[model samples]
Target: IRVTVTAIPIPMACSPAFEGKSIRKEEMYAEFGGGRSPAFELLRVRPEAEVEDGKVTVIGPEIETIPEGSAAPLGIVIEVAGKTMKKEYEPVLERRIHNFVNYGEGSWHVAQRDLIWVRLSKEAVKNGVRVEHIGKLLASKFRIDFPDLLDAVQVTLITDPEQVLTAKKEAEAIYDERDARIKGMKDDDADTFYSCTLCQTFAPDHVCVITPERPGLCGAISWLDGKIAYEISPAGANQPVQKGGLISAENGEFEGVNRFVRKASHGAIERCQLYNFMEYPMTACGCFEVIALVLPEVNGIMVVNREYKGETPSGMSFSTLAGTIGGGVQTPGFAGISKSYILSDRFLQAEGGIDRLVWMPSVLKEELASRLKERLKAQGKGDLFEKIADERNAETIEALTEFLAGVDHPALTMDSIL
Candidate 1:
């Protein structure tokens, strides 16, 4: 069924750009909630020229600009199929914040993706939306009409005075809930997982899948958000394909999983078999921060780094290929790894091994380091623990080259080691 939703801008609340310079009609890198970043265009604009006693009627595309260096702010009325409709707001902010981070000033992005539904059926109701809370979220409001006439709808709005605090608080609350749930999981429990998988386009070989019990290492999407996404589109941006059973080990290969991986990646990840330290095994995302290669002369392996900030072995920047990896199908058994996942050795090592993770966040590195120690203690390999936790230096463009230049362990560097 075709559904239409109207986006009404709340007065003096949502901001779209920095200073008075509004984003023109151009497609740019944007994200919605934790979904993969999508290209967003400036469909239209409505400007509010007058405000009396907090009541404003913003005409099409012209809100007064905030002072210099302030966020581009405004309210809007999004029309869909002529009727007032209910819609989701989280994705809008997610996309906007992502644009700001990658294109705008430093890392200040809005956080909340949860938007309460508003019904907009009649004209009066639709007009009331301009003053309602949902509109306030986007800095505009509306009521829905013919609520039963549609299945779903989402509208995006550009606001003035970006509502970062409200969104951040909501995002944090969701994260806290996720942390609580995962704390109750056993060491080796399998459950449905969620991730951005989109990020792989940029961080290939790095698979980041998050379960209800585990938060993503990047701390982006939460379990609650994942559940909402699944609800929104079971087959589109929201659903996850589950992994079942094990792969057979023949010639160090798992036929079932290997077949699945090849089919999913269209044969891009052909070498992925049953082992972790094997060459060209299925990378979570085509984009990898580092590629672990075995150097026969050194009797060890070295890592070719991607996503590093400095000079790489090939003198390429992380941004050069960050788009190749995270946004598509990953290993067969694993769901897409776009946004979040636990920082565990089992998950990390499944690709190549720890030597590749020198570039992850400090928090994740430390968490993994501590967890590895515990696991090592269990297996009595504690003496061999080298505490490879260098937040500032691990994944630098230089370090990745160094990893590939030196080798300490063959098994650790092999493309697949069952």
Candidate 2:
């Protein structure tokens, strides 16, 4: 059978505004995977003989047939084959799906991996957009973006509950394996690290040196992601950073990192301590997943994520704290970090590690529950996890201090964070 390509009309005249625009709940025609149902997007490298180029298949009802305002289970599986396609680049390519999909007019995508949440505006659906169009859009963009790395691309968009369930299981396994591989990997294991200048668009001098133990502050790019990005585009935002002589292992200072930061920041920052917050902390680019700040009064640190709206133990909200340290300035006693990095073995090793953590949003704590427990246990502080205060436990520094004292929090006895 032969297939025909048709251009689907996008709303808002297909302007760039649609690229990163968010579709609020009321504006959404349909939504998927914001804890509503099983949803995932996966990409795999397949042998040339196994891939059917340009194939776009929708396993269930098309978008046009679905009722407006309905939520459905969705799964996207993309397979590509090329002479140069490597398995290591699968995650990198998979991540592009979010950007490509969001570029479609009236389409909004947020997050990534299994926790992806997407919405199609009523305007797009009314303009004859179908689920298969998503596959087509993705295939077209992938081929254009990675002409040298991808020879054939195929997309399978599934909406059937059984199909989504089966696909989600497989996707979860892949995600787990990727996470495990990254977890087992260490910064010391590599002779080279990577620098991500993507955030430079906002903070021109900010450079993110991504390592295995510490991913990008945005919680989006991993060490592997950075490596793949550099391979794909040598002059792109992600570039290789040779790990030169170690400067101070205790503070995670490297000759190469310091030199690179100085050059990248145009001498704005002369030094940076990767594993410490109080001494020459890395600059924030405003996209960090979490921010940890010293609470001098309590001699501890309070952690807050981008999602937290209430005041933290630092007497500041997330937005307030973000503005203070962001924009490529190295603020002592303040550091931006990824949620996953909070569980890494190298988490703030210089400042007493996780033991320095005194407060975090309850939601953030709950999200990292499993890994937090394991990390704490490895540090022989398994019982300390329960002692950490959240917004519900204490919204003010005074209340937070009292709660920490009551729980016999370890941070109380640690070195003064100030």
Candidate 2, residues 1-418, lDDT tens digits: the string is 1323234332323323345456877888898775577788999999999889889999987776677898888898999999999888887788778767876777776556666777888877777777877788888778877999999999999998899999898988887677676778888899888988765644768988899999888676789889888988898878888778898898899999988888888888898888887978889977677898888877788789866677887878987988799887888999888778888888868988777788999989998899899878887888989998998989999999899999998888887766
TM-score attained by model 2 = 0.78
Best by TM-score: 2
Worst 10 residues of 1 by lDDT: 35-44
Quickly count the clashes in candidate 2: 0
> What digit string (tens of lDDT, one per residue) describes model 1 on residues 293-407?
3333323333332222443233333334333333443333222222223233343444444333323334333534665566667656564344332334444435544543443
lDDT of all the models against the reference? 0.34, 0.81
C-alpha TM-scores of all predictions: 0.43, 0.78
Question: Candidate 2 — which pairs collide?
Answer: none
Q: Give lDDT for model 1.
A: 0.34
